[model samples]
Target: MPYLMRAEPYDASIGAVRPLFFSDLGFTSEPADSPSNTYFVRRIETPLAVRRSLFSGSAIGGYSETSFGSATLANDDGKLDWLSDLDWDGRLVEILYSPQERPALADFTVLFSGAAEQLVPGDEIEIQLRDLLVLLDVPASRGQFGGTGGVDGTAELRGRDKPWLIGRRRQIEPVLINAANNVYMVDPAGFSSLLAARDMGVTYPAAVGDFASYTALVAASLTGTNVATSKTAGLIRLGQKPNGRFTIDAEGVKVSGAWVYRFADLVRHVVTSMTTVTGASLLDVSFAAFNGLQPAVLGYWCDGSSVPKVRDVIDQLADSVGAYWGFGEDRLLSLGRYDGPAATADFEFTERTIIDLTPRPVDRRMKALKLGYRPFGVIFTADELDRVNVSAADLEAFQNEYRWTAVATNAAAAGASLLATEEEGKTLFDTEVAATAERDRRLSLFSAKRKAFDVVVPLTPGLTVGHTVKLTDSRFGLSGGWRGLVLEIERDANDETLKMTVQG
Candidate 1:
């Protein structure tokens, strides 16, 4: 049978297939280290909290009352309740500090009735009731003030717009004309005696108690304890009053209070929660697309030595396309192992010709293995052989010069016509022979012949099928082709063999 010499590198005398190299294939060189493989960016975390407070009173009071009834001893108008018609409604105020000294400070005290009285020179009685009241009011006033600017509440009072109050009392009173007054008699010395006369008890406003509870409620509303409490405490101390209802302002304008849940905690919870949920070591929140389907398998018809670890080769292939995916290394080995033997044998036998010839003198009766080498001969179909476009004269010229064989139309047929034979047969044979010889001569003159034909026979890695692929090599003349998917990949550890089922 006539054989066709597949293109090879040394066949410069005849046309051969050339393989493409990396550079010639139009592939740009990738940096040894790619940013996609190394760079990792993380998101920033936010902060959050809750707060509470009590006694949100103002710096000014507008009401007071006085009464007098019993008087005893050598006392004058001793037992008395000196009262002023002043407003006591609490006003939200931001505290302010003053370095300047002014007489207005002294005059301001008159509004609160800052006065002192003494009954006797030796036996002293201090009528410093106004001073004591002022002293008690200072702490409450300080607490109401808020912010660095110390502006008393906002100019626009809270509760006025919403018609609702936050603390217990939320009403504005009218100014009274007549000064209501009262006088109570208690011998300066007997005042203490009266206190001793009956068991004394102090009463606190119910609203004050409620304010304490509300402060805590506000604090708890903040998510992160430390952050929440700190901010809430600041708002209360600063006594910031928003331009709305007292309750609304208190609830709304609080530090970081506008947040749903502490943003800081939310971030932490999301990252931590998702990590546990996914059961993945590396979890990332990104806008990149994720594939729901498993990766497809690709098969290559390569020599056993040329095929590396399947996983590595596949990964390299995937990397060329900037894809992020993973597969077990064993799977690649299995595919390579399974296809290795068949591919190796086919490549060796089809691409190379082995001649086993024995050279010996007619001496001892013995047999030995001797090796000889020759170029791969060309094979052509009978139809191609018949269509030789050459002249009879040319055929005689070439056949007389070189010992060339005329391929038979049918091997079973005998006595085919040859040169120096019958008219019709001679004519056909001469023409075909000349054409074939000339074709071979032209092939011999061609210089850039292929040394090897890197046939890429795509097979599936597993059960997957019909995968498209592009193979590029500057030194090789191959381009795009389709690769088959993988059906199964199995590895034999004991025998060190990898087997694979690839789509044909």
Candidate 2:
């Protein structure tokens, strides 16, 4: 299967020119939005060796493990050496292909897209490409520490030096003020002392044991930094305006109250907040796709002290609600659920269409799936008392494997029906209801005998991860009506083979 591949440079431009003598005639500059203001694309076409792999999670609690592929260009003529120019550093490169059998250049299709990594010129110009997900991998710092004697106040006591008199204190200023909910987001910045656990204010230390006086000191430290909203179920209520003396103690405020948001809104908030803070071009958010997601709520704490990777945060949030994150073929990051695929399969592959097929091993010997979770509205930690474990077992089997997540309260309900033996753990989720639901959902998925297949078919365009498709194999008893989720795709333009890793 012969094909032609080309790489188009991003942000390439040439200076616009006009006859110098025409200056007397006077000409207006092209508006920024004008079509005439477009940049020139000097297409780079050369002998190339490339391999591309794309992936997405097949179920809840899974994530893409794709390392955006690589390409090598033959620079025998030195014609392509210009790619070493500093101007091309970190540029977006669009890879395109045209079937040798096709006659028209217009028929060319976008095979892959990515940001080019550093380029080192040599006999062969090698280029590394990274997918859009790379943007989400940036480390996000939520709060800045002022150290011992800076903006955060000193570590010493104001007057005397007794244990109760001298303790660390913090005054949290608003990081983000959401007028829609009257919520002021503040990065706790590792300040562990606060009192209110829920909307109804509860006094500190009294609820957290004998540190009442110390809790008072911590509460007093955070006098003005509080959730300004009226008391509501599951929402944080800090000191109300005029009566600004510290009200909540550290232990309670640590898990105090999370600002509840619709799953979609929460995702947007997190992504936008990170992008705005870090200045990373995270592409665009699929608002409509997220809004169409199943009904769920996310409780997010503003404790940015851990400095987690954005990808982990988003993945855990989705997993908590039986959802998964996927970057579509178009490179748009979207969310989908293991249980809630499209009502109908988008594509179907039959014996006639499948060139090669190998079924993945099925794990039926597993006896039970014990999923661990914590009650809602609590900070994630290794505390055993703060966690709950629920199991889904097949009495006939003896094996047991445990998966833990900090973000799921209803693990029992949101788990997928088909599960694999190995799964990574995450800590995120605010309520037991969500955790239990997730546990049940995973138990159902893990207890069943799930099957996956490595399939190679003729170049199939428009195939993407997370989309459900039907498969039929008379020998395997698949009637074509059964749908499987696409977990990974490897496209080899050289051989015209489109390989897929699918699970059902």
The runs of at least 3 residues in candidate 1 whose Cα sits more than 4 Å from the true structure, single-residue gaps closed, are 1-481, 501-504
For each candidate, what is the lDDT?
0.18, 0.45
Worst lDDT window (10 residues) for model 2?
160-169
For each candidate, what TM-score against the reference?
0.13, 0.62
Q: Residue by residue across 30-107, what tens digits does model 1's lDDT show? A: 245221122111110100010100001110011111110110111133321111111111211110111223312111
lDDT of 1: 0.18
Off by over 4 Å in 2: 1-60, 87-90, 100-106, 143-185, 188-202, 205-260, 276-294, 300-305, 340-343, 364-370, 375-427, 479-482
Writing each residue's lDDT as its tens digit, candidate 2 over 211-290 gives 22222323332233333221211122243342222222222112224432445555555555565322133224445565
